[model samples]
Target: MELITNPQPLQWPTLLKRPIFDNAEIQQRVMPILQEVAKRGDEAIRHYTQLFDKVTLNAFQVSEEEMAEAQRLVPETLQQAIAQAKRNIELFHTAQYDAEKQIETMPDVICWRKSVGIEKVGLYIPGGTAPLFSTVLMLGVPAQIAGCQEIILCTPADQYGKVNPAILFTAHLVGIQKIYKIGGAQAIAAMAYGTATIPKVHKIFGPGNQYVTAAKQLVSQTGTAIDMPAGPSEVLIIADHTANAKFVAADLLSQAEHGTDSQVILLTTHAPLANAVNAEIARQLETLPRKSIAEKALENSKIIVLPDTETAMAMSNVYAPEHLILAVEDPDALGEKVINAGSVFLGHYTPESAGDYASGTNHTLPTNGYAKAYSGVSLDSFVRKITFQHISKQGLKNIGLTISTMAEAEQLRAHAAAVYVRLEE
Candidate 1:
C-alpha cells in the first residue's frame, strides 16, 4: 500500500479516485449480448453460456431432482449455519415493514401509502471465482418477506455443468424454486428480457463483475428496474492510536481479497500505527488463498497519515466507501460524523464480515463512490410503495380552489379543469 503524509485537500480528489473501467467500452461490449438474448431467446442464452461459462446445458431450469441432490450434498452443519443466518436476516428485514397510516390534509381527505412487492424479481448470484452462498440469504429472505409473487435466480454452472451445491441449498432454504443455469451478461439479459424458459422480472438484484454491472445498467435503460449501480467491493477504515494493528490489517485484507480491482484505504492520525498495520498486512498476506488477488488490489490501495480525525472523516466522506470501519478510541462519537457509507462497522470487534454474513444486514451495496447517493439493498428494494387517496365532496370543496389556482398559475388548464369538474360534482 502507498503511504502519504499530510496531503493538501486540493490533492485528495485525484489521490482518492477509484480504479474504474471505461463505461463506454464496457457498455459497448455488453450491448450485443443483450440484443442477441432479446432476439433469439433461450437459444442465445445457451450460446453465451457455452461461450462464457464453458458449460453446455440441455435445460436451463434446475429440476426438483437437482435441488434434492444439492440438499443431500450440503453438510448438516453448514445447513444449520445457513438457517441461523437466514433467521437473523429475516428478523432485521422484517422490522423494516411499515404499517399504513392515513393522513387527512383537510376535512375528509384521507391519504395513505401501501408497499406492494414487485410481482416478479430476479437475483443474480456470481459463481465464478467465489460462490456467494451468503448472498442468497441477503436477497432471498427480503424477497420472501416482501411477498414477491415469483423469485427467479440465475447463477453460472461450473465446467462440470452444475450449479454450486451451497447456492442451490440456500435457495431451497428460502423457498425459491426457479433456479436457472445461466451466468454473466447473458443472465442479466435473460432476466431483463424474458427467454422461452426464464421469465422476465419486474426488478433485478445482487452483485457481479464489470460485465454483469454494465449489463444491469444497459438493461435498466430499456425499462427493467435494477437494484443500483454497483462496482467492485471496497472499504475505508479510520484507525487511531488505540486501534489494533492486527485487526486493522485483517479488515483491510478482507475487502482486498474480494477482487483485483477492489481497493482498501486506511486513514490514521498516528504514523506509527500505519507502519504497524502495513507490516501486519504483509505478514498476513502470505497465508491467504486469494493472496495473488489481494496483492494486486493492494497496489491500488493506500494508507494516508492525516493530521487528525476531522480531516480523516472529511476525506472519507469524499471517498464514500461501500464499507466504513471506525477503528478509533471512541467509535460511537466518530460514528456520528459518518454521513456517507453503505454499511458501517463500529469497533475493532465489529468486522465487516459479520454484516456480510449473519449480522442480518444486506451485503449487496453500491461501490465506486456511489454510497454518496445509493443505499445498500434492503426489504424496501423488493417492494414499491403505492399511494392511495380518498376525498369526500366536502373535502373537494375545501381544497379545490387551492389545486385549481396552482394548476392555472402553472398554465395547465386541463389539470385545473379536472379539479373544477370534481368541485362541480
Candidate 2:
C-alpha cells in the first residue's frame, strides 16, 4: 500500500479519481456479451461458461443427490460453524419481519402500507478461491424472513462441473433447493431473462466482480431490480496511535485477498503507526494463500497519515466504505459520528471478517462509493411496500376537497372529476 502524508481534504471526485475503468471501457467490453445473452439464452450461457470458466456441463442444475452428498462431504467442524452463524442471522433478521401498519391520514381518509415479498428473487453466490458458504446465511435468512417464495440461486461450478460441498450444504441449511451451476455475466442474464431451466426473477442480490457488476447494470437497464450497485469488496480503516499494527495489517490483507480489484485504505492519525502497519502488511501478506490477488489489491490501497481524527473521519465519510473498521481508543464514539457505511466494526477485537461470515450482519453491501445513496441488503430489500387507502363517508368528506383542490391546481381535470364522481356516488 502507498503511503501519502500531509494530504489535502479530498472530495468524492478526487477519491474516485484513482485509476479504474472509465465508462468507455465498460461499454466497449460488456455490451456485446450482454446483447448476445439477451438474444441466445441457455446456449449463450453454455458458450461463455466454457470459455471463461473452462468448464463444460451436460446440465446446469445441482441435483438433490449432489446437495446431499455435498453435506456428507463437508467437514463436521465447518458445519457446526455454519449452524451457529445461521442461528444468529435468523435471530437478527427475523426481527425485521414486520406487520403492516395502518394510519388514519384523515377522519375519512384511512391510509396504510403493507410489505409484500418480491416473488422469485435470484441470489448469486461467488464460489471461486473462497467458498463463501457464509454468504448463504446472510442472504437466505432475510429472504426467508421476508417470506420470499421461489428463491433461486446461481454460482459458477468448478472445472469438474461441481461446486464446493460446503456451498451446497449451506443452501440446504437455509431451505433452498433449486441451485444452478452457472456464474458470471451469463448467470445474471439467465436470471434476468429466464432460460429453459433457470427461472427469471424480479431482483438479484450478491457481491461479485466487475463482469458480474456490469451484468447487473444490464439487468436493471432491461427492467429487472437489483439489490444495489454492488461491486468488489472495499474497506476503510480509521486508526490511531492506540491501534495495533499487526491487527490492522491482518484486516487490510483479509479484504485484499478477496480479489485483485478489491480496495483497502487506512487513514490514521499517527505516522509511526502507519509505518509499522506497512511493515506488518509485508510480513503477513507473505504467508497468505491468495497473496498474488491480495498484492494487486494492496497496490490500490492507500495509507494516509492525517494530522487529526476529524480529518481522518471526513475522508472515511467521503469514501463510504462497505466495511468501516475503527481501530481507535473509542470506536463506538467514532462509529456514532459516521453518517454512512454498510457495516461498522469497532475496536481492536472487532474484525471485518466477523461481520462477513458469522456476525449475523448482511455482507452484501454497496460498493464503488454507492453507500452515499444505496444500502446493504436486508429483509426490506426482498419486499415492496404497497400503500392502501380506504375512503369511508367521513374520510371522503375530510380528504376529498384537499385532493380535488390540488388536482385542479395542476390542471389534472380528470383527476378532480374522478373525486367529484366519487362524491356524487
Candidate 3:
C-alpha cells in the first residue's frame, strides 16, 4: 500500500477516488448488451450468458428439482447457518415496517401514508470469482418481509449450466421462486424490460460489477427504479495506536480480495502503526487465496498517517466509504461525528464480515461515494410510501382564502377555480 503523511484537504478528493474504468468505454460496452436484451429478449439473454459467462443454457429458470438437489448438496451445517442468518435479517427488517397514523394538519384535513410493496422486484446476485449466496439473504429477506408480490432473482450459472448450490439454497430459504441463470448487464436489462421468460421489475436490487451498476443507472434514467448505484466493494479503516494492527491488516485484505477493482484504505494517527499495519498486511497476504487479486487492488489503496484520529474521522466523511471500520479506542466517541458512511463497524472486535453475513444489518449498501446521497437496501427498498389526505368542509373553510390568494398570485386560474367551485358548492 502507498504511504502518505498529512495530505492536504485539497488532496483528499484525489486520494479517495475509487478505482473506476473509463466511463465512455464501459457505457459503450454495456449499452449494446442492454439493447440486445431489450430487442431479442430471452434469446439475447442466452447469447450474452454464453458470451460472458461461457455457459450455454436451454432454459434460464432454476427448476424445483434443481432446487431440491441444491438443498441436498448444501451441507446441513451451512443450511442451519443460512437459516439463522435469515432469521436475523428477517428480525431486523421486519421492524422497519411503517404503521399507518392519521394526522390533522388543519382543522379537519386528515393525512396518512400507507406502505405498498412494489408489485415486482429483481435481485442480482454476483456469481463470478465468489458466489455471493449471502446477498440472496440480504435482498430476499427484506423483499419477503415487505410483501413484494414477485421477487425475481438472476445469477450466473457455471459452465455446467448450474448455479452455486448455496445461492439456490438461500433463495429457496427465503421463498424466492423465480431464479434465473442470467448474469451481468444483460440480467439488469432483462429485469428492467421483461423478456419472454424473465419478468420486468418495478425496481432492481443487489450489487455487481461496474457494468451492472451502469445498467441500473441507465434504466433508472428511463424510469425504472433501482435500489442504489452500488458497484464494486470498498472499506475504510480508521485506526490509532490502540487499534489492533493484525486485525486491521486482515480487514483491509478482506475487502481487497473481493475483486481487482475493490479498494481498501487505512487512516492512522501514528506513523509506526501505519508501518506496522503495512508489515502485517505483507505477512497476511501470503496466506490469502486471492492474493493476486488483492495485490492488484492494493495498488489502488493507501495507508495515510494523519495528525490525529479527529482528522482521520473528518477525512473519512469526505470519502463516505461503503463500509467504515473505526478500530480505534472508544470508537463510539469518534462515531458520533460520522455522518457519511453506508455502514459502520465500531471497535476492535467488530469485523465488517459480521454485517455482510449474519449480523442483523443489510449487506447491500451504497458504494462509489454514493453514501453521500443514496442509502443501502432495506425493507423500505421493496415498498413505496403513498400518502393520502382528506379535506372536510371545515378544513377547506379554514384554508380556502390562503389557497386562493397563492393560486391567484401564481396566475393559475384553474387551481384557484377548483377551490372556489368547491367552496361555492
Tens-place lDDT digits, model 3, residues 1-425 = 99999999999999988889976789889999999999999999999999999988999999999999999999999999999998898899999999999999888889999999999999999987899999999999999888899999999899999999999999998999999998999999999999999988999999999999899888898879999988889999999889988999999998999999999999999789888889999999999999999999999999999999899999999999999999988899999999899999999999999999998899999999999998899988999999999999889988888899999999998999989999999
The residue-by-residue lDDT of candidate 1 on 89-124, one tens digit each, is 999999999899999978898899999999999999
For candidate 2, write residues 57-78 as lDDT tens digits. Answer: 8899999889989989999998
Please give the RMSD to the true structure for each candidate, in Å. 1.4, 1.7, 1.3
Pairing residues by index, what is the TM-score of model 1?
A: 0.97
Better of 2 and 3 by lDDT: 3
Better TM-score candidate (2, 3):
3
What are the models' TM-scores? 0.97, 0.96, 0.97
